[model samples]
Target: MPSLFSWLRRLYSLDTLDTRFTSSASASAQTAADTRPPAAKDARANSIAQGARAPLWRTPEFFVYYLFFITMVPLMFKTVVDASNENNPVYAKYSHLLSPGWVPGRLMDNSDAQYASFHDNIPYLVALLVAHPLLRRVYNLFSNRSAQSSTSSAAAAFDAQLEQRMQFDFGFGLVFLTAIHGLSALKILFIFNINYRIAKNLPRSYVPIATWVFNICTLFANELCHGYPLEPIAMALSPGSGTPGDQGTLLVQWARTLDGFGGLMPRWEVLFKVTLLRLISFNMDYYWSLDYPSASPIKKKQLDPAALSERDRVKIPAEPAAFNMRNYVAYLLYSPLYLAGPIVTFNDYVSQQRYTPLSITRTRTILYGIRFFLTLLCMELILHYIYAVAISKSSPDWSIFTPGQLSMLAFFNLHIIWLKLLIPWRFFRLWALVDGIDPPENMVRCMSNNYSAFAFWRGWHRSFNRWIVRYIYVPLGGGGGGHRPANGKPTGSPPPSSGLGAKLQKICNFLLVFTFVALWHDIDLRLLMWGWLVTLFVLPEVLATMAFPAKRWSSRPTAYRVLCGVGSVGNILMMMVANLVGFALGLDGLNDLLASLTGSYLGLAYLISCCVVLFVGVQVMFEIREGELRAGINLKC
Candidate 1:
């Protein structure tokens, strides 16, 4: 077994295998210029990996940190537990699950329905995860045997066979989802088919507009109609089985029978939201593929499918045969990431089928698995001891807890939200890793470690952030003139004439990005407000960066660090308020929280103490990043 210290090192290290894995289509363009000999990259990697700085325990400054950590952690736990146990009705019901030994707190199953679904169906999920690869291997063994005698070059034959096998895999995935969703799966299929047809047949220019409109419409339709149930339609058509042996009655009866399996994944719409992202990815990729300059007839004949370049793999559109319905279906419904994605783009997903990344090694995967189980256990313990989620749902009397404890309620609740998402994303990603596909790691840093709103979003739901950047942010010209002309001339619009115009354009882009993100999460007004509030909170950091560019202060390290510390404290406070409003509490609860915090002198003192503690935490976060830098890793977020 690895030493405990080694495992701790792995846990703290930022350059885990998945962190280095690229899932964005935008990043795939770098693969085109990746001709630097492997040894050069390896040497640089080795130099960076040569040694780490002294451990935290050895650092003198960290003694203060250790003191703060040791004091604060237990106090926060006690605060959360004491607050939870204080006549909260949810705790009273689950008191039997409470333990009084070391951590005296009530235990209960998670109250969040989405997470509970995953928790409840672990046995089935595990069975599917186990059986999927075994079945795939069996299919591949026979496929390779049958394809060995094909009249093609060895590499070309292998490539052809892989695509053929993918068709089988994709078909199987559709069937599997259909089995679980019953007739409800047809709604997904119908939407997929429409998008597929649009990509294949529509003019390249129109594809983007059509794709966006149709998919966005489907979002509303899914919400309004609830995954477009077919059972009602079937019942109407059959109407008590008018003619027992009639073909129409038989067909309608089959539809009703198929609907029975809806219980397996009852709210299929939950999964459809994720599927919508893949749909956009596929259509947009297809649109861009159409725009790529095609090869000459001579080059086309000479082109060996297996000898394709990185540019060919990513940027250049594949042959019509490669983008067919079969592959499209497989890419959309690939079982592991089909539910909750550390979303991989269509191009990236297809490319990985042929060339699995070096990052998905057995050791790395095992370590990832260990990390996942550990996180799950941590989440379970938190749920058991701290009834924060239950407390939040039960509408407790907030007056019972002191200001510090009230703060912990929101604080721990956000952490629970973080873990709820992190555990599931990591679980599915682990499954993908075991199957030799590397999806992006969703949570690269702990929630408490972040001070910058922008950095927090980038690290949290990181794959989705990447997806937003690639599909939504960049295309809308959000980040520094996305897809601008190579010569720096503006294309579709006149240049922003003034500095204010440029800033406004950027802000508008952010609003749109967050709006879409909010709607994507769910079509709720509260989330929309959350999105806008996030945009509002990020502006201070933006202005601060403008005022204090790092290059301008390189000579005055002390002043720069001090300025950053102050700014981070403010950011932390703003972020907490924003998150509390969005996730843990609505505006009313937040208003009540703010009123309670500033309601009296003692409450005000507690608030100041909270800020001081957050400031210290931010310093540790900064040190953690510095440590990463010293060890040759720079996770810029």
Candidate 2:
């Protein structure tokens, strides 16, 4: 009991973790401190010219993981089939069409209609992974002679630009080749049978000639999603009515247009959806660029007053432009990350265009890639098992579940949801290495490595977090710790940080940011409930930290150190529980479950006791693993 009190006294030791997400430059510096240290050099590599060559592809760990992943494709297919619960399933077609002995037929030429449509992509993605690197290497070889002997400033500048990438001719050559092959794949695979259109209830049909007719509708259908005309109309009519007026009433119309097809569109429209932020970033930077010329082609063409809607024209005023067709095209279709992404800012995307990227280590990069690949495989298998065993609510074995089982279910379900993204996110980040660009890493660290909501947000989906920071948070007056008052700095003394007003503002801003993120993930009732519930506890959590600030107690006795260590573990466990609860439960289900926790005295006591045990056990587990408290294991960040 005294020991628990001791922990309360020294609780602030974990303050080195994630601070508030702020746009302030100082806050940015603090966030960097949380990132993993860069990889180290291998001395044996330096002896062979620049470096010892990485092992051949056959022996490489990355190659092994890829081979293993392919081996498990059958199991993945079976899981998908089982989850679908169809009378005549997709995988059933696979066995009928495929020959076991013939590997290519089994993998690619399978007679399965779905697989047949998808087979072209299997080859295309593989070629894309290799083509850019090999082509760039070839370009470098041929251009070495022509790059010498240029004395003019223009030539130097041009060479400098070329050095950032392979020569311009090759870049365009690769682009045209990819675009041709890409268009063929889209036409053959995506365009047939599926009703790709604005009308939601339209049945599937074959139309070779008119797919583009629907494509045009799909593009324009998005104007309604953005609340373009509705927002402008609402503003004109309502003026001071901050409520959702015409635009607010249209959410269902908007949801039906997008969310009705969200699942099918994840691999299709999701590419365009994710890249929208990059476009916004590009437009904003062009608007603000000091050197942008008024008469630039991009300005005259894309931002023409007649071309943009009223809302867009007002919100995104024309800035001078310096157009680079290659950069803009590549930014949109950066094939490695196009399917799913870490949402690279336009600046990072362009800055990486340089010909030389020093961080490309064949050995280290491949090793990291293999690590992610294997981790992803394990997580995916876990999810597959969980789905098979646990997802059916009406199963006859429902009586076998316990409260403890429900807790674990919550844990695994949330992990499954997050792992779905982590698996693909990691694979693409690895693939991006072939392009010589290290897009920002996601899921750098999560779960036990974090002990607070702030830390969790900072660590997970970091690229998305960055986009939110740059485009949303900063724009909305991001937690500026100091501010000049609009009402002119109340008469005498300045306001202090500890005041009730400041505290409420801090909590409000944090919750508001999280709500925005939740809504962005999906505009669903379940997610909205989760976001608000999680935010409810996080406010009190911030208050707890402020109340019991950490103290080192360096010269104090062993008991004090032990108390602090145990308390830190308790905090971590509690935080993770809240996260799982937030993510695990549905809108109605969460309310019922939370109510049951405290509805009975026995239930309340039992739940509290379980938490206490888990809290202390976590500290003991870490000590057993690391020989000290909070000794974090390094990961492939």
Candidate 3:
């Protein structure tokens, strides 16, 4: 059987070669250095090339993803609209399910409940799963094809090489991760018996079952659900009744409690402080700390006073820049305007600060502000409508809903939360475009004059992405080092300065970028998990960058490359675990479980420990940034 298979394979290879050889030999060959060309053939070739390079919107993947998302989004929207309707059985069932925990006269009135129903939309979850793969593939193909067409007739010699090199572990790993998520989704639907398309009559005992189903479903919903577990669960756990009557009673009791305690402000203030602390902690851990520089070069004893005085410091140093914590923080907080940054770097920030006048850029800034405001307005309108519809219906008996109907209702609520969460991305982009301006040098270097234009599509709503690139990528020797180019030359010249041992430097970059990203988003175990998971790409890139400072890692053995690829797959799994944990934590039931476990441990010791870790992280970041700035200043002099 093996011999027969080999013979067939050989025959297939011969046939392929014959076809290719005949086609090429019969085709008209042009002179190697022709001054003139055949117009008709040249036009045809140009047409073919242009077709291949067409915008992503024209690609099959893009269209498929778009169509799928569009369909799903509307379907989910309809589900929410139906559930919020006063006459809907689902609304009545929801009210009944919540009445047991409700204080009469405190819940939303039927009219308000009607508005809230608009929140139910499972389509967003569907869209996330279906759209991501298509978009990623399209982007990968577009990048590869563009690279191939840019080279000379020697393109064939390097085409295979470029293709192989461009095969990033990140993209392939994500696909597998997505597949697992898809399977999880199917499991959710089957186990929960969620009829996501319908708003239906259901009984009260079904509430718990529904809540469980929704929570499970939400876990797999992706960014669309904004990490909310499920609606039924939320309603069951809500502070007030499902109807206005319950809400009024709850409010009165709350007022009485406040009167007994002197006022609500004291407790409210505590809540506010906790929220602020959490936000700071979350951002620090996920966004800033992971990439916090190792230490100041002056502290590390790596900086040389003699080298600082050299005139031709531009002669790329042998060592890459060392990780400095101060540089990271400075990059993070340099521009007060970008404090809520679309994350930028010390170098990019400096360039923009020096070149773009605040007064001159006011018009562009105003427009961006307007855009952001509009997006906020739209989100508010949607949320308001949803709240009004879903929270005001007449209460139903616990006996009214089946387990299946209850589950569907819970899933419906999860959809509402997701829609609410996504509102931030739109406004964030607007804010970045308005507030973040690129310098003139950046315009020339980035191939665009409009700072907002560059940021509009890239970092405007993606401050964390910018943060990763600047604080993590640049320091580990990714971004064009801290200096501007001379006479508009390409920045890809051989390195002249190296500070961190090449291997260590790369690893530092990966760890910092992924770690910071994980911890910056939330101060939870899930974010920590995510940080570790994302480190997959960071670790390899760091090693690869160090191994071949001049991009020579491509020549490394295939076995080594395969190992890196496998490691990346493991990273993706870790990320998925992190994301799942995040979703679980967002659920009230999960929070209750955790609180039960840790509430007793919220002692002075725990508080002190947290403070100490925070202090060390911040101190490290500041020291690194200060060292970098000093080094930069000296170099400039």
User: Pick by lDDT: which candidate is best?
Assistant: 1
lDDT of each: 0.73, 0.45, 0.34
Top model number, TM-score: 1
- Judging by TM-score, tell me the better candidate of 1 and 3: 1
Q: Using alpha carbons, what is the TM-score of model 3? A: 0.32
lDDT per residue, candidate 1, 40-73, as tens digits? 3444433544543344545676688789999998
Question: Lowest summed-lDDT stretch of 10 residues in model 3?
Answer: 441-450
The per-prediction CA RMSD against the true structure, in angstroms, equals 5.4, 16.6, 26.3
Candidate 3 overall lDDT versus native: 0.34
For residue 296, model 2's alpha carbon misses the true position, in angstroms, by 20
Give the per-residue lDDT digits (tens) of candidate 2, residues 268-380. 43244454555555543432332234454335555432223212222232322212444554555566776668676655554445322333456446555556656655653
RMSD of 3: 26.3
